[model samples]
Target: MTAGETVRGLLELTRPINVIAASVLTFIGAFVAGGVTTEPFAVAAAVAATGVAVGAGNAINDYFDREIDRINQPERAIPRGAVSPRGALGFSLVLFAGAVVLALTLPVAAIAIAAINLIALVAYTEFFKGLPGLGNALVAYLVGSTFLFGAAAVGNMGPAVMLFVLAAIATLTREIIKDVEDITGDREEGLNTLPIAIGERRALQLAAGLLVVAVIASPVPYVLEYFGSVYLVVVVPADAIMLYAAIESFEDPTAGQSHLKYGMFLASLAFIVGRLAVTVPNAL
Candidate 1:
C-alpha cells in the first residue's frame, strides 16, 4: 500500500471520530470540576491522555474483533488486511502506556484513575464486552469516567458526579442501540451482547426506555438552579434530539443507531456550552 493508504489505515485503527468525543469529555470533566475554570496545563495533559487511551481502546477492540469485523465491517483496517492484528495490538499497547505515563505526571489521583481506566479498558475488550448488561454498563461508565477523570485531576469531584451520571445513561442508550445494529454479526460470531442474550425488538424497547430516562434527567442541572437560562435553552433542544432518536431507534434499531450518535454528540455539546454560559461571564 502507498504511504497515504498506510496513514489512512492507522487513522481507521484509532477510530479518530470516537477519539474526538472522548477527548472532549476529558476537557469537559476538568472544566466542570474546576467550576468554569480549571488549570489549563493539567487539563490539556488529561485531554491528550484521554485521546491516547481512547485510540488504544479502539485499536485493541479492532484487534480482538478482527474475525467479527470480517462480517460486521469488512472495510476496517484489520478485516481489510491493511493492518495485521498483532500490529494493531502493539500499537494499542504503546498508546495505552503513553496515556498512563502522561497521567502519572499529574497527581496521585490522576495516576490512580489512569490505572483503573487501563484495567477496565483491557478487561472490557477482552472479556466483559461479550456479556449482556454488564458489558454495556461498563462501557457507559467508561464514557462518563472521562469527565470524572478530568475533575479528579484538579482534586475536585464536585458536581461532576451528576454530569457523569447523565453521560453514562446517555452512553448506555447509544450502546444498546449499537448492539441492536450489530446483532446479526454478533449472533453469528457467538457474541453474547444484550440483543443476542435477549431479542432485538426487546433490546430496542429497553434502549428507548433508557434514553427517555436520560432525557428527563437532562433538565435537572438547570432546574436545581445550578445553571442559568442558557443551559435550559440548549439542553431542551438536546433532550428533544435524544427523544427523537430514541423513538426512531425503537422503530428501526439499525438506522436508529446512526442517528443516536448525533443526538449524544449534541447533548455533550450542550453540557459544555451550558457550563461555558455560566462560567465565562463569571470569569470575566
Candidate 2:
C-alpha cells in the first residue's frame, strides 16, 4: 500500500470518532473534577490520560475482534490486511503505558484507578466480548467510569457518581441498539450477545426502556438544586433528542442505531452543560 493509504488504515484502526468522543467525555470529567479539587493541571492530565487509555482500549479491541470485523466491518485495518495483529497489539500497549504513566502523575487513587482499568480493558477485549450481557455491561461501565476516573484524579468523587450512572445507562441504551445491528455477525461468531440471547425486537424494547430511564434521570441534578436553570434548559432538549432516537430505534433498529450514535453525542453535551457552572457541596 502507498504511504497515504497506510496512514489512513492506521487511522481507521484507531477509530478516531469513538476515541475523540471518549476524549470529550474525559475532558468533561476533568471539568467536573476541577470543581472539586481546583487542580487545573491535574484535570488536564486526567483528560490526556483518559483519552490515551480509551484509545488504547479501542485499538486492542479491534485487534482481538479482527475476525469479527471481517464479517461486520471488512474495511477495518486488520480485517482488510492493512495492519498486522502483532503491530496493533504493540501500538495499544504503548498507548496503555502512556495512559498509566500520565495517571501516575496524579494522586495514588488515580494511579490505582488507571491500573484497574488497564486490566479491565484487556479482559474486555480478550474475553468479555463474547459473553452474553457481560461484555455489554463492561463497555457501559468503562464509558461511565471515564467520568469517575477524572473525579478520582482530583481526590474527589462527589456528585460525579450521579453523572457516571447517568452516562452508564445512556451508554447501555446505545450499546443494546448497536447489538441489534450487529446481531447477524455476533450470532455467527457465537458471541451470545443480548440480541442473540433475546430476540432483536425484545432487545430493542429493552433499549428503548433504558432510554426512558436516562431521560428521566437527566433532570435530577436540577431537581436537587445541584445545578440551575442553564442545566435544565440544555438537558431537557437533550433528553428530548434521546427520546426521539429511542422511539425511532424501536420502530426501526438499524436506523435507530445510527440515530443513537449522534444522539449519544448530544447527551454528552448536556452533561457538560449541566455542570459547566456548578459547585458540588461535599456531595455524598
Candidate 3:
C-alpha cells in the first residue's frame, strides 16, 4: 500500500467516528459535572484519554477479529489487506500507551476508572465476545464509564451517574440489536452472541424491553434538576425515535441498529443542550 493508503487504513482501524463520539461523551460528562470551566485541564486529559482508549480498543478488536472480518466484513482494513494484523496490534498498543499516559494525569478516581476500562477493552474480544449477554454488558459498561471517568476527573460524579446509566442501557440495547444483525456471521464463526444464544426475535424483544426501561428513566435528569426544560424538549423526541428503532429492529436489524445510533446521538445532544441551558440561563 502507498503511504497515504497505509495512513488511511490505520485511521480506519481506529474507527475515528467512534473515537470522536466517545470523546464527546466524556466531555459531556465533565460538562454536566459543572467542571468544564473550573477543571479545564482535567477535562481535557480525561477526554483525550477516552478518545485514545476507544481508538486502541477498536484497533485491537479489529486485530483479533481479522479472521472473522474476512467472512463477516471483507471490506474491513485487515480483511482487505489494507493493514496487517501485526501492524494493527502494534498500533493499538501505542494508542493504549498514549491513553495510559493521559489518564495518569487525571485524579485518582478517574485513573481508577481508566485502568478498569483499559483492561476491559483489551480483554473484551478474546475473553468476552463469545459469551451471550456478558459481552454486550461489558461493552455497555465501557461506553457508560466515560461519563463516570469525566465526572471523577472533576471530583463530582453524582450528576453524571444518571447519564452513565442511560447511556449504558441504550448501548446495551444497540449491542443486542447489532448482534442480531450479525447473527449469520457469528454463527458461522462459532461465536455465541446474544442472538445466537437466544433466537433473534427473542433477543430483539429483550433489547426493546431494556430500552423501555431507559425511556421511562430518561426524564430523571430533568426531574432531579440536573438539566433544564430544554432537555425534555429534545429527550422526548429522542426517546420516541429510540422506541421506534427498537420496534424496527424486529424487521430489519441493520436499519434498526442504525436508527438507534442516531436516536442515541440525539439523546446525547439533549444532555448537552440541557446542561448548556442550565449553565447559561438565556442561551436556550
Candidate 4:
C-alpha cells in the first residue's frame, strides 16, 4: 500500500467516529457531575483517555475479527488488505499505551476504572464475543463506564451513576439488535450470539423490552433534580425515537440499529442541554 493508503487504513482501524462519540460521552459525564469548570484538567484527561481507549479497543477488535470480516464485512481494512493484522495489533497497542498514560494522570478511582476497561477491551473479542449475551453485556458496561470514569476523575460520581445505568441499558439493547443483524456471519463463524442462541425474533423482542425500560426511566435525571426541566422536553422526543427504532428492528435490524444510534445521540444532547440550562443560569 502507498503511504497515504496505509495512513487511511490505520485511521479506519481506529474507527474514528466511535472514538469521538465515546470521548463526547466521557465529557458529558464530567459535565453532569458539575466538574467541567472546576476540574477542567481532570475532565480533559478523562475524555482523552476514553477516546484513546475506544480507538485501541476498536483496532484490537478489528484485528481479532479479521477472519470473520472476510465473510461478514469484506470491506473492512484488514479483510480488504489495506492493513495487515500485525499492523493493526501494533497500532492498537500504541493507542492502549496512550490511554494508560492519560489515565494515570487521573484520580485513583478513574485509574482503576481505566485498568478494568483496558483489560476488558483486550479480552472482549477473544474471550467474550462468542458467548450468548455476555459479549453484549461487556460492551454495554464498557460504554457506560465512560460516564463513571469521568465522574470519578472529578471526585463526584453520584450524578454519573444514573447516566451510567441509562447509557448501559440503551447500549445493551442496541448490542442485542446488532447481534441479530450479524447473526448470519456469527453463525457461520461458530460464534453463538444472542440471536443465534435464541431465535432472532425472540432476541429482537427482548431488545425492544429492554429499550422500553430505558425509555420509561429516561426522565429520572430530571426527577432527581440532577437536570433541568428542559431535560424532559428533549428526552421525551429522544425516548420516542428510541422506541420507534426498537420496533423497527423487528422488520429491519440494520435500519433499527442505525436509528437507535441516532436516538442515543439525541439523548446525549439532552444531557448537555439540561446541565447547561441549570449550571449556566446559576453561574450568572
TM-score, every prediction: 0.94, 0.92, 0.99, 0.98
- Candidate 3, residues 195-223, lDDT tens digits: the string is 88889989999999999999999999999
Higher lDDT: candidate 1 or 4? 4
TM-score: model 4 vs. ground truth: 0.98
Runs in model 1 with CA error above 4 Å? 35-38, 282-284
Give the TM-score comparing model 1 with the true structure, all chains together.
0.94
Worst 10 residues of 4 by lDDT: 275-284
Best by TM-score: 3
Residues 1-284 of candidate 1 have per-residue lDDT tens digits of 66677668878999899899899988888887763354777888888999999999888989998888998999999888788788888989999999988898777887788888888888886789889978889899999899888887777866678888888998898899888888888888888999888898788788888888888888887776555567777777777877788788867776676777777787777777777767675641
Minimal lDDT window, size 10, model 1: 32-41
The lDDT of model 4 is: 0.93
> Residue 230 in model 3: shift from native, Å?
0.6
Judged by whole-model lDDT over C-alpha atoms, candidate 3 comes out at 0.95
lDDT of each: 0.83, 0.78, 0.95, 0.93
Q: Give residue 157's error in model 2 in angstroms.
A: 0.9
Off by over 4 Å in 2: 35-37, 277-284
Q: Look at candidate 4 and give me any clashing residue pairs.
A: none
Could you give the candidate ranking by lDDT, starting with the highest? 3, 4, 1, 2
* Counted clashes in each candidate structure: 0, 0, 0, 0
